[model samples]
Target: MLARLLATAAVGGVVGFIVFHPREAEATGPTATVDADEAQRWLLGGNAWFVKGGRHVGDTSVERRTAVAPSQAPSCTILTCADSRVPPEHLFHAGLGDMFTVRVAGNVAEPVTTGSIEYAVEHLGTQLVVVMGHERCGAVKAALSDASLGPNLDALLALIRPGIGEIEDLDEAVRANVHAQVAGLRRSAILHHAEAEGTLTLLAAYYDLDTGVVTFLDSPPTSAVAEAAASPRTPAEGHAPTH
Candidate 1:
């Protein structure tokens, strides 16, 4: 049964699962002790470098490549839209083995995506999880339309609809969508347990296409005030494609 399931996952070519029981509660890595603050700072610094066209591409040297070929230890997990323009690595100026990314249309959290995230949190030593929404998201925009969609697409639209509320503004709805994904992620037992243990931090962010700015949204207890709070915005790299 396990072999069959793994085979099916491989055929789908969407999410590939590795069945392994993690040892202990601590993240495993050379830099396993990286806390939530350091993860956030690293992302911010990467974005700064990216915006300035000084992207420090990861250690692509043959020796360095061979070193990490044995294993990966990403510091963060980013759940972002599948928009071709919003590649998480480019936005954060990351290189190979630096980040574990989960991408889906509208960046909505569904079972498959959630499962991938759980795998990262449980096995990849990732301390930070960012659910990012971008400007002019097509998925959110479609929710505002009455156009008929196929069952699969309709299901995706349904997940994004509630986030939009009654707001007609696209940008506002996009931010709301990020908050919604963050909430959905919290429903995962693995994620919730990690956060409760102070080993994880969940964040929401918005990526503006025009300015390449990524503004971190305030988290819970302050989430209600996120829209109003003046957040520190960093210039992100890359252009976002409509997903």
Candidate 2:
């Protein structure tokens, strides 16, 4: 599968060139080695507060904006759906320059998206990369059926098809796509080196529209999957099924 994944990238052309490039990126400041565990803790805590109707913890003030103007030292990079309801900053209570985010229809990890991720992990010193799949995603729904939307959207849906082969359930298919994206990203030689040296981490996540909670959907251990199941959510926090 790994070989096949790289072969797909090579045949596609862009990712093959970008993945094996010899250039390395240097962090602008210290603390660039912020580990994935620490970043995940901060994100989860912020999300819990968001669900509980607490105040936003992220600073979006002028001072904060000016500080990060020259360079950004975000702890993580998030790639999620371009769906309006799944806004990363609002969902996570993140401020300006807090995290680098890549938003597209299906959160697909193709050559261009993967290349952007490579920049963040290699040059920006980001420690964590999250590929988030949410409930009731329209892109997944369209891909599950044989609907011809248009040329651009059709191309986008085609990228998501293989990840969700033979799956009929929308929620299950969404999770499957997330795992498939993570696998494709992990095969990058640059990312492979970072993981091999214990510097970078790639993981999948799920967001519940009702609960406003983000669940880490990685290969779980120590009963985290059960412990982090859906919790009671507020009526106001629940979205109106826009996703």
**Candidate 1's residue-wise lDDT over 31-134, tens digit each?**
34455665665566555445555545443456544444545566678999999888778766565556678889999999999988887787665778999999
Best by the TM-score measure:
2
TM-scores of all candidate predictions against the true structure: 0.77, 0.78
Candidate 2 to truth, TM: 0.78
Judged by whole-model lDDT over C-alpha atoms, candidate 1 comes out at: 0.67
lDDT of all the models against the reference? 0.67, 0.69
User: Model 1, residue 240: displacement in angstroms?
Assistant: 23
- Cα-based RMSD of the predictions, in order? 10.0, 12.0
lDDT of 2 by residue, 107-184 (tens): 998888888788778766778999999999999999999989999999999989999999999999999999988888
